[model samples]
Target: MKKKHMARGTGALVLVTGLAISAIGNPAHAALSGQALVNSKCATCHEAKTDQHWTRIGESRRTPEGWDMTVARMTFAHGVKLSSEERGAVVKYLADTYGLAPDETADHRYIIERTPSVVEHPESKPIGDTCARCHSYGRIAVQRRTEDDWRKLVHFHVGQFPAIEIQAGGRDRNWFEIATGDVAKELGKVYGYDTASWKQWQAQKHADASGVWRLVGNRPGVGAYEGKATIARTGDDRYSVAMVMRYENGSEESAKGSAIVYTGHEWRATLKQGGRDIHQVFSLGANGAELNGRWFEANNDAVGGTMRAVRADKGVPASVLSVQPAMVRAGMRTTLAINGVGLNGEVNLGRGVKVIKLVEQSAERIVAEVEVAKDVASSSRDVQVGRASGAGLLKLYKQIDYVKVLPQHPMARVGGNGGSQPKVPAQLEAIAWAAGPDGKPGTADDIRLGAVPAAWSVDNLNKMAAEMQDTKFAGRIEQTGLFVPNGAGPNAERKYKTNNAGELKVTATVKDGSRMVKASAPLIVTVQRFNDPPIR
Candidate 1:
């Protein structure tokens, strides 16, 4: 999700701050003192003796990215102008002095580490109701700021989302006042920037991040993948990376990217994968032994997963990364390839799956033609190589009894140039999982059988959707579960006489044994997204 900002606003505080900062004539290469710079540029509006204004600034710290964002907002929204060199000096000073205490981020490291499929929320009720209503709590908790900055954030919300004051719990008496006052103060007290941790972190030496590494990642509904990455230092704090990944379904993808490390910890990258842009956010472990974070599609934050990389020399023994064509229809003959390491001996393609021919064999890979019996039941079993002594690294499923539409709550935008901008379509997928013993649904024991063939369709999700005729106006779903939305311009012929946007239900059905098992997922067809960040 994109961070909202005030579009237009003016107040006595803004005027004073602008004039005071501008009054300090631009200087050429004055000694880079953070305090002196702040006194000349900000003290007029903040008044150092106010206790909650300039004094608060002196007491708080933040990450380099955090400080950069704040400085950018001040320049563009609050008229705090500075030369490029002065801006850099100011950011460096603030980040180095008022940065996050090492212990401050210990509990919430997952926010920067990007642990996959984890759900987190703030313990505070008001924070949950107000802040988390639009974005993840981790986004708010990961940053360190002063009470003054926190108060500004509250005002920023009010200016950007005016309806927030009258929405749900926000409608309570003095909601806005409390948010800009007590709530901000409390947050600053708990998440303050200055601490012994930051001092210690700043004094310690950081590890160099350019090297070869081994990586493993897991995307929900997409299974697991493993790869090798080569990182080369391109600048003092920038790196270029090349990676090759093999997915559980036997597909291989190559990616190239560049990254900038901030404050010696945050790793942000822009990568290209399969002709599409992907953004990555990772944290370099203090020990320099690993980099843990998340990578997602640049257009959609929801389509991402956990990423972990360790020095290649420190990685574990060779093992199977994934099996190609993990699932196959029973009674059909197809070529199967097992890709991994240590595959020198005879291969077993599991029970109920017959090995028709051995086309190729090697210590690290094997290719064979296999056939499943018509009477085989829908089940998953491991594939072993080199008999019982060899490694069992693959799973072959004979049937798909159930289908799940991935991204349970999908949001797709209508496409057209008529509105703010043309929208991007959403790609969907259907995953097949084998039901466990007793045929119960939604159990922990259910085995993911990988992607399978399924029929797809769309319908209105509610009365509003039906009245809007979304099924007709919106896009259609392909057999592969991809949703292609319609244009965004107004259509006088439609019932709503607006763009093709509404709530939709996408269903996927597959034949399991003799019965058809199906799953439906909610989808929202909406307006164009303006800010598409790497991680939401």
Candidate 2:
């Protein structure tokens, strides 16, 4: 990972990221393994142990990016010089030796995925208002540390970011004491270094990642895609990958790259597709039965899709991966696109639905048209094709009562214009909500109809925004629900020569029959963010 600096700000003052992974141990830095290099170089400040471990280095564990940030911080703050090759080796070494268990990172995958416009609600308000204000709750939860180490981290934060005492809610009380005494204690209990999952993971045998994988996922704003990935072992813990994917419109794209498998399960691949750099962060499932993760643009984390893949050979079981839309209205005719591995035989959709037309059927995909009974009860429906079955793959609903916008509150940044910083855009989607059995909207029983087509537009958020004509200057929302922010830099034509910044409302208008269902989300368009660490 390259060095990225957290700018000088109230939140960035805390040393969360902007760390550079440097060379470890030997001065010549040649002909040495990653561990030996780390053991040699890190001992300068951190005391080396008899068992080839360092003081604080072995006291905590994190993901690859977390280790990258820690080492990068050493390079940035402590002036450690690290080469890209050395950084990769050391990161691989440390991540494999001291990495979080898959179970530990289950709830915090969003941070690893670098998802955008997420509103995190930390279980503890103090942690949310204090530490999370600087980064994300997932960034904190992704690491496991001992109680003593946690306490020491609090002290380090106070020493580095003295403004922590005055930043937002930090000024209200004794922040240091609360952080060291209570917060650290809570974090230790929740994110303890010694966990059974980690122990089991370390002891368990690792599966090889060389095989043909059937991939199925949806590219946001685009459509559904089904593909195949061929992985071949190239070296120790590394493989060469090739993927060919076909979208719903019959268009195809292929990507080829080299991948590194970390901690047995974490699969990281850097590839080129359609003349653009891309990356895949997927986890190889048990016995290499399945691979799950996402692929995103190298420069933009928000532009990506959810990926689920199953092994295509080596006696992999027949599986029904997914059923598109998932939900259908009663008394309606729907076309279902089924994606899976080795799909064949009978097509079964639980009660009140029957296949009327078989558009296409193959070993990997099956397209069928089905008719839904009008009197069918609203309930969960299973989908099965031959030996493969997916539970609760379909939901029977009566009507769509309303529409809603995801990421109810979002933030966009202006950037680019013969500059380095790229503009950050908003990927918005409109969802149709069905009033479930209770027939009342906004209840727990409401069902989601996924992404629906909508006319996108932006308006001033409030009186001040209206007076400033914020919508006119901020950016434009495309018809496909994509909000592209304006370029960075000050506009001399604007009042006070301010940059293109505004508080706007993103509105999605969906035409359902004669009724026009509409929904709105607040969007804040601001100046460029200079500090963008992977974990943020």
Candidate 3:
């Protein structure tokens, strides 16, 4: 979603005050209760009954961030106006009363957590084709709203993407009508804001999230890093943070940022690191002892990593934070170092992995030379130091059952020098995963054995793709999965005089035992990115 920037000016405030007076008969403004404030400000345009329930207001719940966006939209798009204090009270009231149910967010955590290489399928076919066609379903499912708001959102879409009405399913029937009518109502019913869960959560005491924390994070292309963060409360549920990190290669960096914690558990931060903006979306653990989330480059959502933070003073148990060269090839001997806290005593590197020699030992780290058996089956195993165990922290794999294409669904822009814009290529990586004992594709037992050598190829996803001559015009995928798109603009060499865009499929095949296992993901050859935000 595009970020909304609030307009600032005395003129805008004056305009808002005049609108407020016209909407609600009251000219005097005072510190009103949340309900009273909503009744006076929002209920003027939105219908409100005697029970204090506003038509659209009573039907939905949202995070503080979501409510903030909504209020901004109302002021900018609908001409709703209120003082800063009034806006805060309204947002707080709405978020507190109408926030997300834990159950509602359970299935869609992958988006919030930004787990890498994840492929999500929509729950309904209509939603998949209509809503998820342009973006992820998580973006849609994450918010709650009333039928009116849902309808308004549909209108907003039609206004923004005028061609949507004539595209694919949109042209199949009364798409706009259905989307603004039954579909909107259905969405409101399923993802409505009011729920018993919100009430329960609102009544519970929230943990204070202020203090020093130890952080461990992994960026896909950059490897792993360790850091420390010091946070100080700035306002109610808001904080300022400073952090420093050290990469595996001894490179160091630092950042300063601020964060807002919505619903007391959702922590979102914007930090300036290495002169670039970064967005961190994390969930404060129930106990408030840990923070688990993802941090990404604000302009490119794909360039991010899994992040975890633990309270520095909580006296955490001995745990392995990371292992150098996380994965090793079968039959190869390598020196491995396990880094973490309270590391001592003899370390066990799991079965099929034998320690060749102890290279180093300390209270916070352990290094040893290890060897892996060539015939060992691929799987993640536990690494132990006395009684403290890191389960599934180490892997000893001999073969890969399937390969995953990173950024599973990627868009490659056609290259050109006309606008002095070099074509943006998609850097793809094929990660190998070892099938579990069951030899199944989807199961908890499946283990990511890490990046491995694989043969790469591109093809058409369907008959229409083939008819479009995607194989001939879309571009090509190298043996390493790096996709370089065709030149931009209309091509006289092709049947259709249009930009060489097409729907393509990327496949990675690997040799596993006596069989060849392969995996495929979708790709789109398209135009260049114009406004590249840090997170998309």
Candidate 4:
């Protein structure tokens, strides 16, 4: 050096001295001076100086625009605080020194030695030299990926900064080879290529989905109720599950149900009700013959439930063998004038996958589920009325004697041994459907709800609330459902043998203090139909 001048606190002097000492011990240390600069700055977020990263930078040969985006990402996304000018300079340096070349400079070995590694060789940012500047090495190495994948990722890092200025006497490809090629080769052989090691290393993050269930349905105030379902798999053919349907007030109502499948034919279920423990049993007939044995919970329960799944119609579970049914191969950008008041949305392909999701909701409208595939997607919306409207409708039905059974109403069936027919409980039951694409309600079909109509308004809600002023958020109500004693009147008997495709309409006007609102909606009911008993 031409009379080396001492600059205090520069750290340059100390760094140079340290390097000299390190070189004395191991000459290879001398080739990494430029990497040392990157280590002091760029490595704050990236990995170390390694051949893998250097090679990536060499191949990009990016223009100034590329470097601008890269630096902006660092400042915006990663919280790097470099000034705009500084970022520009760094990009210039990289582009000049390592930009792609027509010669063999684009080769991997040429760039690797030019790059640096994370301080401790993290699996994610292994070739970043400034790794120690921010995070501990242990936090990074948990990810598992292949060597080639790692190489490609390293390239992304270098391309992000294209304006790095060229430095005289800067060693390039040869330097890169020693750091990345040799070291990574050794590490890969030692670590193997799989997630097993990463899992073992990060065993703390493992999770199990025991006792998780999702429940869904459509009832006035009953959007959906999800809770733990007592579950037990009965040998190979039977699966038993029990869940409590909770009301708005948070009181529990037990719904004990189980499905029994015999041979490879169909599945059958019997549902019983109870306060704490179930007592009676009522068989629910199946729509699909094979349904007697196959019950797919279908993310329908809240995060906890035991649903013993049985193969209803199986030839090796077709859903698993094929690609997702919703994937689109090709289609025109055709628009369908979506009908139904509460239903409007668009489905499109994103990147390479199709994503279908709700984009908006209209007044009183709720989408039960949405799906778009290739050229087909279903959208829906519906309205929800307030408690006042619901009470008003029920009262109207009662006034008109439209309600066939009285004991089911809490007001009519207060005392013990109250009514002849099975009482309708105060709690919202699973939505019973009347008609769908196939036309039969409760006959078993997927019930889809379009958007809520404007009919379900704050004014309507207020009006409905006013009607229930006496009830006043009473929380939980005690009522029974359609329970008929043995020797009851004709209408009083629980008619399990008959499937009645009944319908329910409700209009409510609710009051929020002085302001009033109104809402109305429709409901469907499916009752098992009973025909003339055989004249045996």
- The CA lDDT at 173 in model 4 is 33
Q: Write down the lDDT of every candidate, Cα atoms only.
A: 0.64, 0.77, 0.68, 0.27
- The lDDT leader among the candidates is 2
Please report how far candidate 2 places residue 113 from its true position, in Å: 0.5
lDDT measured at residue 285 in model 4 versus the true structure, 0 to 100 = 19
Residue range 1-536, candidate 1, lDDT tens digits: 11212111100000011112211112233445544566677676557853223654654555554565566557766787665555555555555445564456556665554343335657676666656655567667767776777888788788977887787566656878888877887777766545566666767777788988767776544556777788998654557889887776668888997765655666667788767777677778676767877787764544666677766553334444445676776687888876555555666766778888889986455789988887676566666776433233433455565677766567778866565455655556677877666566568767677665677889999998888888998888776566778888787878857878879998888776687878898888888665432122
List, residue by residue over 150-221, the lDDT tens digit for candidate 2. 889998887988887788667777888888888888888888899999988877888898889998887767
TM of each candidate vs. truth: 0.68, 0.91, 0.71, 0.22
Per-residue C-alpha lDDT of model 4 across residues 229-314, encoded as one tens digit per residue: 44455433335666554432345556665543211111233445442222111111121111111121211111111122212122
Order the numbered candidates by lDDT, best leading.
Answer: 2, 3, 1, 4
Candidate of highest TM-score: 2
Candidate 2: count the clashes: 8
Pairs clashing within candidate 1: 1-536, 61-98, 62-98
Clashes of each: 3, 8, 8, 118
Model 3, residue 208: C-alpha shift (Å): 2.3
Off by over 4 Å in 4: 1-215, 218-221, 227-236, 242-258, 262-266, 270-419, 422-506, 510-536
TM-score for candidate 1, please give it. 0.68
Scored by lDDT, model 1 comes in at 0.64
**Distance (Å) between predicted and true CA of 514, model 4?**
13
